[model samples]
Target: MSSRLSSRRTRAGAVLSAALVLGSMLVGTALSTQASAAPAPDVGIAATTFADEFNGPAGTPVDGSKWNHEIGDNVNNHERQYSTNRTSNASLDGQGNLVITARRENPGNYNCWYGRCEYTSARLNTIGKFSQTYGRFETRLKMSHGQGMWPAFWMMGTTGGTWPNNGEIDIMENVGFEPNTVHGTIHGPGYSGSGGIGAAYTGPRFADGFHTFTLDWSPNLLIWYVDGQEYQRRTPADLGGRTWVFNDRPFFIILNLAVGGYWPGDPNASTPFPNNLTVDYVRVTNTPGGGGGGGGQITGLAGKCVDVAGASNANGTPVQIYDCNGSNAQRWTRSGNQLQALGKCLDAAGGGTANGTLVQLWDCNGSGAQQWAISGANDIVNIQANKCLDVTGNNSANGTRLQIWECTGGANQKWNAAV
Candidate 1:
């Protein structure tokens, strides 16, 4: 999700109240639990990879070093009440947490870079500085209540200016009534604001406490992770673009809890005041060898790529890597992405896969003999054999060693493809 999003005066307010009172009393149950009413995501897909762990700043909101404050309506969600700065807008707890509170105050009189002052909460971001290109990003947060409260955990491009054109990613977002469900969304060309790519997962009411929400981004895919499991995916195409915006330029993280909007409707009398968007932490990670030579800590179908201690990439004939298509030879099952290919993915040991050894694919019948894994940008090994898959005899013959051998860290171990 990229950059992103209210009403009127006394008489208009009265009319708004009367029409809404009848509307809510008529649809109170829907208003109270609006699960079915929430919109769906753009691609309705999920990722093929994710992070086993994370790395990021924690223990406190890093003040001017990591972020600057902003008022609402900068992205135009139709909010009348201004997002003013106060103890309410944003602050760090010193206990590895951040508090972004919204208030119904007299309009802020101090000069702000954006928005006319009014009653509301704060918006803080990691833009212009501290932005990242790709990594495993996550946050644990608890949102406030109000018919209008729209709390979110999202990202934007580093290029700055303009809304969805620059790209956006919503790792997690919550509307008031549906406090138990968190949303993951994306915004860019062909998808913006309420019209962007999005999805939701039901969980205990977030207002109860902190829960983890994540995004694992790579060159070809962006995955939405809810407590470690993948739920949604967006490729450059699903986002209707040429460049993978999330992959091209740097992106910054955004943490804010907004009050009512055209989408969340408006905050009502029963809505709570001074709700909090509590963040426990933010983490990130990186793959080695840039984008090539692999090694992003991915696992595959059970025994799909494993054959124990096989060679790295030293084999002479280039081994073809294919998308794990779930065919008998391709399916790799694992808790995360650690993989064991069927028949050593078949390369020669120590880069020797004997030219005439017969490289054939097999079913995932769960035999360690057929298990193999590629760890890091280098080292493609077979765990069961305790040897490297090498080019038979180191003879660069076109049809030579596609077999296994012991580790030597030779040329056969070097992989050619980018991750």
Candidate 2:
């Protein structure tokens, strides 16, 4: 992964003064087109937490309440495009879509690495305005055709830290060079830039039509999907020893159309001018079985609660049974195969496949030992061990540590998870 990172960090405001003059006189009028209806979401998912269908009258500016433009071409990614806060760079297309266009025209005196700035584009984000902790976030868009064009729909942690320290999630990133492939990745302190943990999905060219890119994030896991078919899954285990920081904070979304970066290289004479990344919509939803920002509890074995031992946030915290008393420590949120409590993931110690392995709270890593599946009989079975979430004994006593044992139709093995 490190081999793919750009050497320079592109700042966004270095050429603002020069670019403003070009946009100063280009205030285009909004097209007054008819409003369109929003599209329905995937089946059986949680209700929509937020959505921008882009169904408003064409030619209008994007909703200011939902997004803020990121202008300037100061630097980052070694890209050649000058980002600007101009409607011509980003605006609604009269036909129910948000268009972020990258043009070949130079704007003002802004100069890229080669010479004068040869391209112009736009970037927008939901920074202070909106964020979510855990949920299924997605967007539908068609790629912009032309070499040097880079388009992405991604997110960054809202919590303060540094770039990788705060964490970054690339829901989708595609360069015109890899027209048929899109990448999804997660970056943290030790696994950022070229070292980010992620994967690629390849198929028909996305520029051929609009397709959806989805990311389902939970306590310790991130699952990526292209048009609802999952292609990749990552967790703390995949971090190679780095800390999992996503569980500790919320993240905001970003959309951009870039030109000429270290990843995509520079645009050539063959590259077309004024290409567009057309977006249909963006949607976010709480997972059906995973309570994200709004958490819930698990009830089982004499109605005792599955609680995080001592409410500790450290890895390897024990998961124990206690009398049901609502508390943050007892609140469980499920996403993909992960169950989280107290900002830690529910894990099977040492990735053990043997019965009697203890169930504990640990930093989320993509380890099979921590993956669980609820059976038709209501048994919470750990997939790696094929063992059931069990009480140490049939005794319904408090302070009993949870363990994995052979599946049995026993009362102690039954759980009513409120995910």
Candidate 3:
């Protein structure tokens, strides 16, 4: 995301306390054999497309063929750490883990264009060596805890496009100030940087042990989970006027531990040194299980577009017939049993099963109200209602409301996808 964070300023003190508490707790756990509450990633070995268990000897460098180090200072988030390729900053810990250590270092150790640098860390990416179009991306790791610590598991498009325009998927990001919370975000033109579309997950302090951060990505959706518990989902409809640039494009992964910056602020005297982001493993898989389909225009009834009236993303937005304008409001994606537009599912209002039931936009759930299927006759039918998607009163004029009606083989009941 972007560098600015005016609101985070007030949360700085709380973050410091959390950092200290988390560090203490983690040290205790590491010293004992007691089981941790943190959960490891459920990496289906049979479905793995890529995996790194970091099983080399302690201090061994990362596999050059699988990753590249992003060396720099302040990078894009105005971070205070300089990322280097030093094994001291990133290496196998001998215990089947990749340890990315952040330390207080003098500017003499590393050249910096922003004057003296007091911190050093590591940033690794899979830009040229590995990239994926859609699948599951996950990592098991214990985050570093400190006032200025910033650790992330994210991805960027590998198409050599500019920031935002190319696309950025933050699978999981945590600022030391919020050690108990992790964020999942998507950055694209018109909705990038600090303005990226996303949400946060808050629970146990993940630094105490290892926890899994995962992204179930498809052509039209991104579902985030922490230790297998779903927390957030994002789609093109969430971007408002922005373009959805994630479809069918390859994205490479990145792992980094940064110190200081605008979001978490600079480290203070109370901040701990040698903070480490310990990763148990990183994995990728290609089994697209939660319904996969290309997002595109949906047409029916005289070739009119199935549109979101007023381009509204709000719940209960009317699903109407309109001239095809190729707007996001007309863009639809199929996720599981639901037909989604504007991040909501098309629903037969009130779960109405009879004819003349109005169709509207509703929050996506696995409910039968949102379930639909294409009939052999090419009708868009609501499965639960057993009725066809039809233009109200058979009127093809723009702005006509859509409804569910008994199958009548009318032209209005027939649908097509110009996907």
Candidate 4:
């Protein structure tokens, strides 16, 4: 249900910067890694659409009523105090920048639960508000320094009401002392910080300059980057339990500067107090061809084929995506829950429940064998295979093999899906 999106809009005739897919850019000695390409953007699904940055002239200011700003909590970091105002702490630079200032102040805000703030600074979070299912999330920002200064812009699951269980995406995190290296990490049931699945890309000292950090989320896998340089590649196993949980629910963003906690320990006297995390802007774009499958037009068909988007042509051929042309070849008569095409019923290969079961067509048995349903505006599944009728990794290549496998939430699961 959730996915990462990355696309840009341009004027007529203007050459757009095409998105670099999951396996697009090769790093070090390679051209690309083996991460599963995320599902292409399915704009049809409202939850997976575009987002306007906070109250900038770009669009509307993400209604404050929707986002809950977190402050005064030690969270995990042990630094100073927490403030939301742009005053002495954090603020928005009209030029598209978010500045979070950490300064030495009297311990003013307190809560016996996590102790009080001794130093005054700023931290912002998108915990209770907006989070897209899938899209590119990038922020141009500069960091501050000090052994105790821990600043991060990340995302967490909005459900299950817990950490790791819900999922955590640390798009950017840095400590005051380690002024040069920046990190990107994912934490969930199976993975956490140190022992969890995490990696970092060393750009110039992030604390000294501003850089853009991005994550391309696709149904197949996760990819990370710093100024467009590939840094990490991950599969479902590395994503942990959050893999299923994250895709199943909505998530939100959080921008905060923690004083100290588990990762970066307590701050010392040498640690500078008034440090800052300045963000230039946050922009999101939508991928066009619904996730996984490559795209094609409605080809051979009979009188405007309805209920038929990606069905097979030749007899005994595994189901494949074909162009709909209102022709007999593409049209199917719907009988309640049944889709009759080429005189064969859709059935699961070997009627297996395991993942990756092949999908085939056989004589309709009228049993659950021929039932079908679609969840997102563009995702389909057979009642039996529980596997989606995908277009072979959405490869758009003609004659790509169509085999049934357990559902893995890749772009392939997403069909031109008329539903």
What lDDT score goes with residue 37 in model 1? Answer: 21
Q: Report RMSD (Å) for each prediction in the order shown.
A: 19.3, 19.5, 17.5, 18.9
lDDT of each: 0.49, 0.72, 0.72, 0.50
lDDT of 2: 0.72
* lDDT (Cα, tens digit) per residue for candidate 3, span 350-388: 676766667787654445777787655567777776667
TM-score of 2: 0.61
Better-scoring candidate (TM-score), 1 or 2? 2
Q: What is the lDDT of residue 51 in candidate 3?
A: 76
Off-target runs (Cα >4 Å) in candidate 3 are 4-45, 289-419
My TM-score estimates for the predictions, one after another, are: 0.53, 0.61, 0.60, 0.52
Model 3 TM-score is 0.60
List where candidate 2 sits over 4 angstroms from the true fold: 1-3, 7-46, 112-115, 288-419
In candidate 1, where is summed lDDT lowest over 10 consecutive residues?
Answer: 12-21
Instruction: Return the number of clashes found in candidate 2.
Output: 13
- State the number of backbone clashes in model 1: 98
lDDT for each residue of candidate 1 in 1-419, tens digit (9 for 90 to 100): 22243111111100000111111111222111112221111111113222211122433334565566664443345543455556546666654457777776655453322345445676767656566777666665666766777888787776644555567788888878786787888776556755677788896777875566667677767776554345677776675544445666677777777666666766788976666777655544443121221122222222122222222222122232233332322222221112323211232213222222222222112234334555454554555555544444444433332344455555543333222
* TM-score, model 1 to reference: 0.53
Where model 4 places Cα greater than 4 Å from the true spot, the runs are 1-66, 75-80, 83-86, 107-116, 239-244, 288-419
Tell me, by TM-score, which candidate is best: 2
What value of lDDT does candidate 4 attain over all alpha carbons?
A: 0.50
In model 1, what lDDT does residue 335 have? 17
